[model samples]
Target chain A: MPHAIKMQDKYGKDGFVALLLESQGLDASDIPGFMWKRFPTNKTWLSTSGDAPFQMTGGGLPHAALVGVDGTLLWEGNPNGAPKKIEEMVEAELKKSKSGWGKGAIAKKARGLLYGKNAFVDAAKVVADALANAKDDEKEDLEAVAREIELRREAFKKAPKVLSEDARYLEGVKAAENYAKWVKGNPEWENEANAIVLDFQRPEIVKELDLEKGLKKILASAGDKAPTADLAKSLRTFAKKNDGSRMAARATLLAAAAEFDPNKK
Target chain B: MTLSRLVRGVGMVVVLTTAALAQLKVGELVPDKTFAQMLNSDGRKSMAELKGSPVLIDWWGNH
Candidate 1:
């Protein structure tokens, strides 16, 4: 299928015109006259040639001026204050054609598609697809690659998330929570998740839960035995002191702590 | 002086032989031909073309 054309905001017509004007050391006012002349209303010009007259505008303009249909500067001025050498234009066109501008848009779309999903699952699908389609000679190596992708995906999936019912999910959730905390930012999910993860038996998860000195108090209360009950009590205490999401997070921590079992066989 | 000159000539021959051996020959297609095809479908054929001679098929990484 022909790739969809996504007009990149970075290469707008204004940028192209600006680049042309800057190169020529002229202003936008200098552009309208020559541009209209070369691309007269009666004459139908290719999109590429449409910008040729704008090249007279020199350095005062922005880089936005030179963007053309295919990213080639349709009107780069020569040293002599004329449009760039015909040979240069021809060479540029050839290079642009060979480079294929449509491919960039396609790649960008593909990248967006990949990043939009949960990274682990999306990456696994990509690897699986690659392996399934690999040549016979490459099939052997692709198995290892597929396995690696699967391993990573499994690790990510098993990693804990805030509010995850599973203990394993807490690991990933805790990491995300820590990251959010360190940034002095609180994503709603991460805050909620952190509360749940903090209720886990893991000391690291508890520490990052940032229950102030309550985490230490809970740790001190349960030395050898499970601190699950102690952690739950501390969470209730913390909840009483905080408001809004923090209160909710504390309540989740209390609930999660009650379910945690340090002596699970 | 004559022995040293002979040894130098032999050394040069050995170096030249090693260089020739290291040079990649034409028609050595990448084993991952299907990958090339997939990449080509996504508009990455030019990369595959650079892998060898004969048919210069290219492939590209989509982002």
Candidate 2:
């Protein structure tokens, strides 16, 4: 039986890339650019500016009371009290590590600016500003850029759609299968099999669909009252056997789950 | 030997003293009991819980 791996231990950068390639049919090389664009650096002055006041308060300055010019506090404290200052608070905050902010935050915000709100208008202005003093030959390239921008703008203007919860479970199941294959091909990864299992059986993912109950229902329908461990094993085996179609089916299920109506269905 | 050098040394000492006072030292944890309670009860607890479980905690600001 293929052991489960923890998502945190197994679903790291490399694992995520592998899963995207296997399940979403995305190339690892193509992923980096999309990931990068989706999560552009907060180091940029604009992104960093939004966080400066918060960081100041986090690092120990009473930004609201002390930093605020008005009656309101400038920055609210982390649910906890403010961080302590070792030296100049501003300098210390600027120097702190920038690893806490994840790709999701950047992606969500970038997507909002690019597709949500009036991102297209804002982008058009930026493009216009960039092309204002370009050479005559550069005009064609600028126009092409504008066209591409318009296409993206239209794409963003459309409603926000996310994968369904059921599809996500199937993706998790597919990821588990891929991890099993990778482990089989590369025996060296066997030591990390348990971590890999945990990754596939991520509590958050399971919690999203009430998977424990769903799996039980599926098992009950099949007239099998086996333990959860056995059911999980059976499901993993089924997913592995049905590879490609399973991934698609999983994606569909997830899309449906995302827009699921428990009251109706 | 020079007045400028003497003034620079005094300035360094004052700066260092202020920095030392601002910092939360190992021994100073006793003096700031409320601060320590807040840190342990509210701040550290969440981090510890996240570390113990496979949960993703996002730290963000409204501004």
What's each prediction's TM-score?
A: 0.22, 0.21
* Alpha carbon lDDT at A83, candidate 1: 21
Each prediction's total of clashing residue pairs, residues at least 3 apart in sequence or on different chains, is 39, 22
State the lDDT of candidate 2 residue by residue for A1-22, as single tens digits.
Answer: 0001122224222111000111
Where is model 2 more than 4 Å wrong at Cα? A1-119, A129-133, A154-159, A162-265, B1-63
Model 2, span B1-63: residue lDDT tens: 699999999999998655533522221211111111110011111111111111111122211
DockQ metric for all predictions: 0.03, 0.02
- Fraction of native Cα contacts reproduced by each candidate: 0.00, 0.00
Please provide, for model 1 over A83-119, each residue's C-alpha lDDT reduced to its tens digit, 9 standing for 90 to 100: 2343244344333433322223332222222222223
